[model samples]
Target: MDVFDRMQNGYLYRPEDPNLGISNTEQLKKQRLFNQTADHTILKRMFAAFGDGSQLRPPLFSVWGGQFVEVGRDVKIGPGLTLVDDAPIIIGDRVQIGASVTISVAGHPVDPTLRRRRLAFNLAVHLDDDCVIGDQVIILPGVTIGKGAIIEAGSIVTKDIPAHVVAAGNPCRVIQQVQVEKVEPKMAKSEFEKMRDGSLYLPEDPAILAEQQIHMKLQYQYNNLEPGDPKQAAMLKKMFADCGEECYIEPPLHANWGGFHTHLGDRVYANFNLTLVDDADIYIGDDTMIGPNVNISTAGHPIWPAYRLKKYQHNQQVHIGKNCWLGANVTVLPGVTIGDNTVVGAGSVVTKDLPANVVAVGNPCRVLREINDHDRQYYYKDRRVDLDE
Candidate 1:
């Protein structure tokens, strides 16, 4: 079987030893080659500010600054994937991400008061090792995926996913357990040499690279102002009145925005192609970043069905706290609160409140674990910078 198949189905040649598969040198070489190519593609997207080349498989598309985030090794990011990390997004090793998937780690509130003022909030998303995410899924803010979990395609994850389980549906749930195996293979010396020497080509242009950087900075600035800055604050209020607090309006390169409500706190970042439907309040905290194509909705339809047809709608409140990271394409629904130092995984749909210092991921996002020193050390080491210092 091909390497991709092996990675998906596991390395087992027989049913009896499902966890065991080919361990030859040739197979290892092939995997390495695939990884190198994939890494190159991910780097080309450049969606995060703290991204590492050793962590991703390539041909990835980052809508914003995806190059800054940190990703683990053997992680597969499929085509048309979006990671929005206006905050930090931390991914673990051997994570399988499917095609057209989105991991979002930031969001805003829907409250009219906050929205009118152009205030935005953020939550973090985190994913552990050996998690498999399905295609076209949306992960919301403040979610964490446990080890060896599976998320079905087109599912909306807003809660936490336990380890060794399968979750699916619109608001993803725990369905079953997952079985994993290891495999190895041998490769030709020539192929191995090519992979090692890096004979691959990725789109490279200084202008585009510069633009991406500039965009990230501008977006950061858009979310960083305090209410005291009158000129900027007045502009922010006007912008919020015009476009809501969490709207994702692309700014022109090298241009200063007069008035719009977009503000991120210290150490906050997001992934690529993040579409913020900020018709309301959106607020984020310090040291938090979002993933690619993450859609944060501050506005929701009426549950009564009669109000659904209305052209205008009310807003909800969305809040994310400090030192949190969100995954790719995560969606945060209206009126949710995410506490400090949390992590959310990819393709999750957040529909509720998440407490401080925990890992939560899935539909209707739940608390997975309390944040400890280990979690802090893994994601925050050498990454946070104090501007005031």
Candidate 2:
């Protein structure tokens, strides 16, 4: 295999390998020229893929120059950007990277002897679309910041952060989700505030309906488009408060608030006729798959007929954790927090909270059983999971 492949695969390779020859000469030359000139045209010429309207200032540093880096459209990269681009560094569209951000993909071997020989490996770092990296943030190897995520200044990102969250600290953790402004405890509450806080409120409040109607217009556009339309993603990003990467909701999505109160995580797939009563909030975590005809609601009304006639409604947030599978015709009720890696059977109504790693079915959704070793060995009842058939 080639030396480049060896480095990228996390197999250590020596920089002084004779067969590789002088690889850094051209990169170094371009790095010097770009930094001195600050001409964005040179940036376009340097990287693997530098999209249109992306700009970067001077004082950029990279060992392999910008050869392995990919910058998407309309990205604003500030000055003093440092890159150890031995592997790929992919920056997605509309990404705003602050000054003095260091992104490193190269790492030395832990073994002393290997370190003495200057053996190194590479792992790619990715910053997804619309993410903002604050000044002096250090992103380590193999870390992917998800779509619309914001990294606080002076933080060190050591792990992959989930989409649409605000993360901070030395080893960054998500301090808060990034959909709406936090309501102050002592502040005067509006009708919208009442709805968000789970108190009885009116959806017909003029201000609230105005925002919902805007989303409804966008949703109408989204639902009527061609099935495989490219516009769906951008529309979802605009409509939802926190819409992550690789999330797909098959059209004919019915949402009461038009997804104004939803936080969708990455790799989430929803089949046709998925309904979201997202009045307060609905957080569907990453890698969760929803079967056809599932209804997840966050809004409810009073049991009393008098309050119902007056259009009194209350909302409770629903939180579904990562890697869950909701079968067809399942209904997840308000205020329920379903844990990670759980499977909800078809035609089940989840009225209460369900724990992780269990199979739940039937009305009011009681736990059928915990996911066991036997289940992994068998794909179905009495059917073995055979690799070779």
What TM-score goes with each of the models?
A: 0.35, 0.52
- Which segments of candidate 2 are over 4 A away from where they belong? 1-186
The sequence of per-residue lDDT tens digits that candidate 1 reaches over residues 154-239 is 78899888887878987889987666442111111121122113222111222223323433564466556553444543343344
Backbone clash numbers for all candidates listed? 125, 0
RMSD of each: 26.9, 21.9
lDDT of 2 by residue, 240-319 (tens): 88999999999998998778789999999999999999888999999999999999998899999999998989999999
Worst 10 residues of 1 by lDDT: 183-192
Best candidate (score: TM-score): 2
Candidate 1 ranges beyond 4 A from true positions: 1-63, 179-389
Candidate 1 deviation (Cα RMSD): 26.9
